[model samples]
Target: MSEAVQIASIKDDGAIPVYVARPAAAPKGAIIVIPEIFGVNPGIRQKCDKWAANGYLAVAPDIFWRFAAGVELDPDIEAQLNQAFGYFQQYDPADGVYDIESTIRWIRQDAGAIKVGCAGYCLGGRLAYMAAARTDVDASVGYYGVMIDTMLDEAHRIANPLMLHIACEDQFVSAQAQAAVHAGLDGHPRVTLYDYPGMPHGFAAEMGDRRHAAEAELADARTEAFLAEHLA
Candidate 1:
């Protein structure tokens, strides 16, 4: 069992809903777990739970609430893909940074989170990078983040520790885009990127058919290790 709490985000001139998970015991630090474009669904909740199980306070904000609240899509492949694209059309990297910043502030004030980190998947993955670039989070991790090619210019602002997990077989983001992201890092000592073969996008999600349990476990271990290293 885990402890869950409702969090509020002050963005878009109003408040947005968020879910927070933590162990019954005190937490070591705070982590902002960004959800995919599908919104704050079950998968994201499970992620928060997993982090909590690892002894951290994990919070996931509904970035889509600014456009539509309580919006959830079907899990079918085609339907999910279509809905994800539609959601992405309404949100930009800037909006993501704004909403995540609000969540970070809220956690710092309400949860007494002394250290902050971030991790996201797919669309949320890109937003993690944006948060690392624009916010004061101590660290960030992005798993197969799309649209990284377009945000390369902002990489210079990413002064915190950053980790990126890329799928070698990803069809959406090309090799050129990956290269651009690497080049944009420009000798950032705190940043590291990894490419995993035979894994598809959203591989970290255990709820979907594409869930590679082995790869997901490996990624989760890496994430835990990264958080331990940076958040400590």
Candidate 2:
């Protein structure tokens, strides 16, 4: 099992809280785990632990720290979405990207880190794509990223390997939107896209009713393989 520790983020104003998981043995590399609309909740923390188990030092920065540090809203769609949306309305994606960039810089300074990659869910998935386009991480993976079809112009900027898992039946990311994304990124050398036939948004979340076991398992396996190839 990996141990979770609180780490300080590199920032101009003040330190932000980042949860890091280190493997029992030396790390093969490092990975940044971006959370969903909810902050660094149990699920996101578990992802950090999972990556650590997979041999990478994993870090999950509290991106919601700007609005409300350690804000972890409920996973219930009806109970939490309004609040999550409120936070989303207040949050800027660019700022989140900057925070991730800072986390990347932190990863670079780590003695155990020889290569760095990132993976994200929901809103984070979109940020993972942005990280691929903007940051210097070795690889990135995104799951059901929101509004990514609108940012197809940035596809060419991605030089590092990037994987995107799109939910075919996702209401948030409709079939048409997925097609647009495929149209723009289909032939990109560094971009790989995976489509889950009947899955909906948040398909990989343990707390959600939309979770699909088979698809999540397959996507995760692919993600690990992709990481192995690129972060090697």
Candidate 3:
């Protein structure tokens, strides 16, 4: 089951709207599911629901609340797509990381969670990478995270486990960016990088035309195992 809730944010003491999903029984751990620039829509909520069903407490924060609160836009919709990008252009990753840090604290200190992991998609994927580098989150995963190669300088600060899914042919992410990400992250003991040869951005989306079922399943299985190992 899922509910809409608000959590305390360190930035300006604002309330970060969140979509929370709790397991039927006691949760084994907690996961913060970050959303794309499109906001905490159906696809993002479904992710939390799946995690909750699998016995993890899941929360997705509205990191875009400062700009647009409770906004759900479809990437496939032309007008919404442009609106989403406009919000994306204004988003600051540093702020997103702080919001993630607050979520981590709430999970551990307030929610009594033993361990916390985070999985992010698209814009969220980028935030997940930042959380891995900048927060106390125990584990982090990113699917088609954008601009990760630019922030690799912070990779040295990653103290816990991190798994990243890269869509090799992602239209939003250039081949050079992919190459840079590989060069920066490959062989990093704490980070695991997986490349999807023919996939594009949002290939693992819970819904919509972008989802590639087979590849999503493979990546999700890998993600689940990674979370289990580290969060355990």
Best TM-score among the predictions, by candidate number: 3
For lDDT, candidate 1 versus 2, the one ahead is 2
Quick one: how many clashes does candidate 2 have?
A: 0
> All candidates' lDDT scores?
0.82, 0.86, 0.93
CA RMSD, predictions in order? 1.9, 1.7, 0.8
For candidate 3, lDDT tens digit of each residue in 52-167? 99999999999889879989999899999999999999988889998999888878875685799999999899999999999889999999999998899999999999999999
The candidate 3 region of ten consecutive residues with least summed lDDT is: 105-114
User: Model 1, 79-152: lDDT tens per residue?
Assistant: 77798788788886677788888888887897784798999988888999888888999999999999887988
Error of 1 at 103 (Å): 0.8
Model 1 TM-score, all chains together: 0.92
Candidate 2 per-residue lDDT, tens place, 1-232, comes to 5444444545575666788888888888888999999888888888888888878889898888877998887667676878888888888898888888888887777644579889999999999999999988899999999999999999989999999999998988877889999999999999999998888888898566767888888999999999988889
Q: After TM-score superposition, what is the CA distance of residue 98 in candidate 1 from its true location, in Å?
A: 1.0
**Candidate with maximal lDDT:** 3
Worst 10 residues of 1 by lDDT: 1-10
lDDT of 1: 0.82
TM-score of each: 0.92, 0.94, 0.98
Off by over 4 Å in 1: 1-12
- Pick the winner on lDDT between candidates 2 and 3: 3
Clashing pairs in 3: none
